[model samples]
Target: MVLLSCLQRCIQLLIWPVYILAYMGLWDSFYKRVFPYIMARFAPIYNQKVCKQKQELFSNLRKFAGPSGQLRLLEIGTGTGTNFQFYPPGCQLTCTDPNPNFRQFLLKSLSENPHVQLERSVVASGENLHEVPDGAVDVVVCTLVLCSVTNVSKVLKEVLRVLRLGGAFYFLEHVAADQSSWTYFWQKVCDPAWKCFGDGCSLSRETQKELEKTNFSELNLRRIHVAPRWSPTSPHIIGYAVK
Candidate 1:
């Protein structure tokens, strides 16, 4: 327990610098450019596990991947194209991210996933997807995205606007932990620092709840737990909501 105590203290001590960087607006560059480099090493394994855990949910999405009536998939905040392997052939994917730094990594993944045609690589945020048209997308894939958006509700509305009738929005995101837990308290306390370095990742964001508030014909969500290294990424939800 002594080692755990020391680790906690170290984390507490380190938060101050992150706060300073965020306030100074320097964290944005670090988050966009530097963080992806570090994440490229670990995110693949984490994302693969996430996919495996949500395999049943993902199978439903596979139905859209076919030559006849190819699905137009809009993946918001497509960080390093981590979800590439999950997609099957004949998917017309339009990837968007505010950070241009991820372009190279995303391109590499897209090149490997030749099955899914790269429709567009827009350097834009989820809040404003003007590059994509209304009622154009069949599936809006938003994994690990809502937590960082400037406005979750607004983003959801935008998503609803873009999806055609009966289109599905598949989401896998880490939400705020249970209110009574120490994890919740710690998450709340560390949110600012977490957002600073984590590219706007808010540990306390109730993303699934935000999804519930949206105008979906049906909302199906399930909670999940990941791990310590990805402590902020735990207490997640994986499911789809039909528009």
Candidate 2:
């Protein structure tokens, strides 16, 4: 069974480059364009799985609202604005994603969730949020993002830089399973191939460790298992850190 799986992966890896070359560097465009459609089909199932956790994570966001009685929230890697439904009524949200392809879907989501106002959508990576000013936002939210970033620590630093004093950074991401586990073994084996097909998302990132090492003033993070231990994304972290 293992040998057959290995052969299948090898075949995929061998063919993937040819597929990329066929696109002539337009692989990124194709991936970005198709990803939204894939996510649209998958989002409902994933959302249902994480609905409770998301509600808990986004609870009482109004407490962070400023004097104007509105929250200035910036979401990194805000693909299709999936979290918009969880946001409080008076939030002016700034969304960012490296893929411009997600903007149209994100706009549709914004229209559906009329309570959340769109500040703007910037095509930027999490590691370099230069377009957003320093200390300009009251809250930074990232879900399913850290695993894809080339540098998790650098992205956390950018989150800290953009958040105002006493602001919060909310994150929910899948991380590597216990090192001794079979899931971890598969995660290591699948990560490279996963990155190629999954838009640079690493299957085995120790995202919790990076968050711990970061300079957040208060870290309120915890891990939960949305799937059984055998699953690659079994163990997930969901919580917020005060800046």
Candidate 3:
């Protein structure tokens, strides 16, 4: 407990500097240029750890082919295109991210994964995907996104607005640990600094609860614990909601 307390204090100490950077408006630029590289290195490890779960969740995507007979998929927070490998071949993918720097990396991934063609890449937030038409996509995907969004409910509302009738929204996100657990205590303790350094990721957001309140016609969410229990990001939920 002493060591944990020390760790918590250290994290708290780091956030003041992050606040200063953000105040100066340098934080967004810094994250834009650097976060893609960071995810490039971290994604493989995370993908491997969640490989089975991703396969299970992604497999349930209804094959609602567009007029072109290709699955139309819109992936919000398409950081570095990390989930590209798991997408079905011939998917007409539209990608979105608040950070524009990720576009090059996304294009690189698109070139490498020739089977999935890019319909467009928009520099937009999850809460405002106005460029995408109503019922424009057959599937919407968001992985590790809800924790960082400014408004989770608004994003969910936008998601429902954009999906075609019977369309599915598949999400995989690390959420707040169970309230009675040791991890939950640490998550609350570390959230302030985590948001500062993690580009607005909240360590203790009850994302699953938000999903429950969303009016999806069918919701199938499951809570599971990933390995490395000491990490605040270990507790996760993966599932889909249909419009």
Candidate 4:
């Protein structure tokens, strides 16, 4: 029985990579586009939880942004522009995504919200945000985005480059489990395949450790089990840091 179970596990691990690659190829074309639309269409069902969290994050950000509401905010991986509604009226917002398919959705959201100034561009990750000037942005916001980037360290470095001194970087991301041995084992076993299907997202990454290695200071970390948005069993980490 033990030998059979071990063989089964090994087979699962071996087949995972192929499945992940196929999944990612299909996801990049289909899931990435449709997922945002589905999320927006079903916003009412998810927004209560998502919005509450956004409100809290934005509130914390407001202390740094000040009374003028004149924040130069940059959002990386701004899919479907769902986060546009969360910003205050006077924010100078720029949203970027590698996928050009989201352009119309971004424009529509910007048009509806007259205060927002929109710029659509193809940025593969934070490293590719050369169009945005260094130390120009007051705040950098990333929600559920880091997992898909090709190189997280490069992305974080780029984030540091664009943010002004004392500026804040806010992020909401789901990462690899730390406590559960079984979950961690599976995350390690399936990461390569998972990345293939999930837009280069690694379930084993410790985002906080990456943040600590960056130039940022005053890191505030929070953990929450984001129920049933994407992965049913995964937990999420949300935090902000000063650059």
TM for every model, in the order presented, reads: 0.88, 0.92, 0.92, 0.78
Ranking by TM-score: 3, 2, 1, 4
- Look at candidate 3 and tell me the lDDT of residue 172: 93
Between prediction 2 and prediction 4, the one with superior TM-score is 2
Model 3 TM-score, all chains together:
0.92
lDDT of 3 by residue, 48-108 (tens): 9999889888885646566667689999999889898888888889999999888778888
What overall lDDT goes with each candidate model? 0.81, 0.87, 0.88, 0.73
Lowest lDDT 10-mer window, candidate 2?
3-12
Model 2 TM: 0.92
In model 1, the Cα lDDT at residue 45 comes to 81
What 10-residue stretch in candidate 3 is worst by lDDT? 60-69
> Residues 90-157, candidate 2, lDDT per residue (tens digit)?
69999999988887789899889999889888999999999999999999999999999989989999
Alpha-carbon lDDT of model 4: 0.73
Those runs of model 2 whose alpha carbons end farther than 4 Å from true positions after fitting are 1-24
Misplaced by over 4 Å in model 4 are 1-47, 66-69, 119-124, 189-193, 228-233
lDDT of 1 by residue, 1-243 (tens): 464466656676888776677689886666667877877787888876776765666677855433456888999999888887787677888899888888888989988888888988898889999888898888999988898899999899889998988888998888898887778767766775677667778998888778877989999888878776347557888889998
Displacement of residue 166 (Cα, Å) in model 4 is 1.2
